[model samples]
Target chain A: MSEFDEGTAVVRRPDEAVDSSVFDTELDKGWQIGGGINGGLLLSLAARSIGEHFAAARGLHPYPVSVSGYYVSASRPGPAELRVETVRAARSHSTGQASLLQADDEGRTLERLRVLAHFGDLARADEDVRTSATPPKLPPVEQCVGTEHAPPEFLASANMLERIDLRLDPAYVGWALGKPSGEGRIQGWFRLADGREPDPLSLLFALDALPPVTFDLGLFGWTPTVELTAHIRALPAPGWLRITHSTRNLAGGYLEEDCEIWDSRDRLVAQSRQLAVVPR
Target chain B: MSEFDEGTAVVRRPDEAVDSSVFDTELDKGWQIGGGINGGLLLSLAARSIGEHFAAARGLHPYPVSVSGYYVSASRPGPAELRVETVRAARSHSTGQASLLQADDEGRTLERLRVLAHFGDLARADEDVRTSATPPKLPPVEQCVGTEHAPPEFLASANMLERIDLRLDPAYVGWALGKPSGEGRIQGWFRLADGREPDPLSLLFALDALPPVTFDLGLFGWTPTVELTAHIRALPAPGWLRITHSTRNLAGGYLEEDCEIWDSRDRLVAQSRQLAVVPR
Candidate 1:
């Protein structure tokens, strides 16, 4: 098998200009919903390209402290071009906008995704404040139910289910059985299918890897994300990442979900908030 | 006082090209923090500009569903140019990037703020989901303690205190007396000093108008925001808006806070999440 056989192909560099690169959406095919790539994977691809640009252009090892992505259009499989524009470069932080585009038959570039990311040094410690929120209680990863062996119903419908190792908390798996918990919360362990070590970029995918928390409230189907913002609190340790997702309000044909990611060490690694359209 | 005396001046249009406009930051003088305008005010200005652009260019009444702002530099109080670029104009939503820039003596514009915002229609209603979160309990606006009459201690140091009418939940006010509740939560009522009706645009300012919830955790001083994202859930009713702010994790010299706004009818209006440098 090729080295880029799995999701790593999403970050494979191209022989293009310094500010641009090409990505293959083949690895992301399994994650597709409603005939389009998952929004989380598209966001991660844009972030990976922007991070590379920050490193090559400004010599900054940028861990995205905050990333806001607007899903302009659905990204299709095949080749896509990522264009990066440096909005501002400072000593400690740099801000940039990256666009994921595809070429039409006439070679006109069409935008599929746009993201704004803020990069900072995660290791730089000045003054630290103790965290007040602790990770939620969950069964060990081994004891949890992995999606790899999900029911034929979900597997037959969602090919993306096989791309990652998602061990959902047993208490919340009722949704898979057509019995939702009636609560907008989910907690579980998540890791990429290819077993790459978790990093800031991977955290982007991890944050959105789970199905919409609204699904537990009997709102099912493809709840596409309108916009998503993720904040990196600390660099994650190498192991299964614990994710706690909850939604406070669902109103006016829209809902917002907030997620907190904790490393195996119980360190808060990242927090994300997203606005999505409620399922019909 | 002229017609542009109050909050209306914050949205003053510039008679320039469709892509650019100018803003007088003098209207923001009262909201200063550490000799510069508060980051929230700057974000609101950017949102206002982008909203206007969406309205003019696409004929859509753009309420910001998601806004991400990176405070690249401290904005000086004066006239600055707000340049808007339409990133993508879709059928129901339009995404845009706006930069707030300050010009030098020679008219070379220097960028001070960069923002990406997703605008959606506030009037469009589709299938709705029930909200699970409730607004915090607080005294009536008439009985609550307004910042207008704050003790000389806080009022003397924070010049921004006088520009907004904030009624703190008395239970959580011990921090003002150097007695912290040991919890990172703050509930309050907010409205403009000039008594403007609270709209989707004004809700942006109200979300960040209060002091950081970290202050309740015994941390103080200017906790500058590195990035902020706010989601507009519903249009607010005309009355004092209820705000509930809380923090989950504060570590590695950074912290994240979440805020929820509710109109007088007890309906959720907007929700915001921000990442800021921890107070030293």
Candidate 2:
């Protein structure tokens, strides 16, 4: 794993029992867009904390099957506490609600983020059903344009892009070049910059890592997410992950984007849907 | 609006503040599937209560943009109270968390359902970006098969079907006729059985009202939903909502389904994604 990956895997110091797990970590500025931490990075941090707690306490490997997070306040790049509370624990699955809180100097805690997630056993296997959808076809990674080589203005401003390696499908490079495709869609390959094998937790970040598909429709600038839900279908295999983000309608000041992530083996590993606001 | 729509629109008794709103109503037996109230119907009830509260208290017509619900316990058909608590109210949107709780003989309350929803103003409008995806082509409602006319065994046991009108796309009728298509997809048109004009709240029910798409992949029995998120793009235009439900992969004992709802004008009104357990 890269140094950034190691930095993000900060361990949480449990308070007392497994029911409530607490962690304090310094938000890496590298994960910030503008002054606040990227929402997907925060989600990944929360998922990792909760997943570890469940795995340790229940002796069951808790693979995040579904996670929905509502951003209550902007998460700044500083000290933050993630408190995960177990809501329910059943034989087959477990549910947890977590809050990323920022405290004031007076020691009063304020919620910055909230998430509800369900975890199921990742080791469990199932019979494969015939699938009609195929993995998106894209050129080799070397042929795609990496965000690292993006314009100086974008690379300098979008600090979060520096933390992860993202390569855009050649067909979508026009959007980054200020040419609106008029198609609200983006396809790309992504992986942790530190060479960490993609896991369910990483999938959480990957689901929302893409620039809002709305950008391709000629709307740009902070497309704040209202709520995001991701379903992890399978544990991703090692190597880069391919993702396709697309939007169907942009109306009522809100647009919905659906993302599909395919693993190295060309298996569909995760799917996500989110509602986001267009920049004013 | 029809009697059923009126009945479903139970009034909430607020406690003199915008923070909390309460409503008590009997869980309609017609909304039950195998004894538990339908998850989507419960979501609709919560959204209605929260929407009403926000409208009356803040003068904001907070239509649901996104709603994610995690069923904590099986909601039985009986009296229940829905308590909606304001999570945050911003200038452009408001967030609320709600719980459908049941009280035992001793007045001990138990949470049966929990939901987090973001509401955007129905009065707000924005310039539409061009959309590339079109509504699915399906047979007219008159030519399609209705679930009400299903086999006696299915009709007798599936009580929830009686509460809504669902007309299956002709291409998928073979699945209902016992032929597994090996394709996990279903397209249909849906609306309230009572002929109420389809609204944002009703769209919530319509999102999950269909049978689990996993059934088409030869995986049968109860495929209980783990988490469901729906994004309302535009308000429906008072007619049967066209919906297409499809699944990409069924692996790791779980599967993800995506649903798109289009108004009569062929405009996409809402989109939904959910993770559900495949029957063991």
List chain A TM-scores, every candidate, in order: 0.87, 0.92
On a 0 to 100 scale, what is the lDDT of residue B208 in model 1? 87
Share of native C-alpha contacts between chains A and B (below 8 angstroms) recovered by candidate 1? 0.80
Provide the lowest-lDDT 10-residue window in model 1 chain A.
A1-10
Instruction: Report lDDT per candidate.
Output: 0.76, 0.79
lDDT of 2 by residue, A93-209 (tens): 888888788876787877777888888777675755546668999899988888664445446667788668888987876666778687788889898877878888888888988
Note the DockQ of each predicted structure: 0.68, 0.60
RMSD, every candidate, angstroms: 3.3, 2.6
Number of the top-ranking candidate, with lDDT as the measure: 2
lDDT string for model 1 (B216-278, tens) is: 887766687888888888878897888999887788778888898989898888888888887
Write out fnat for all predictions, comma-separated: 0.80, 0.61
Clashing pairs in 1: A30-A160
Q: What is model 2's native contact fraction?
A: 0.61
Q: Pick the candidate with the highest TM-score.
A: 2
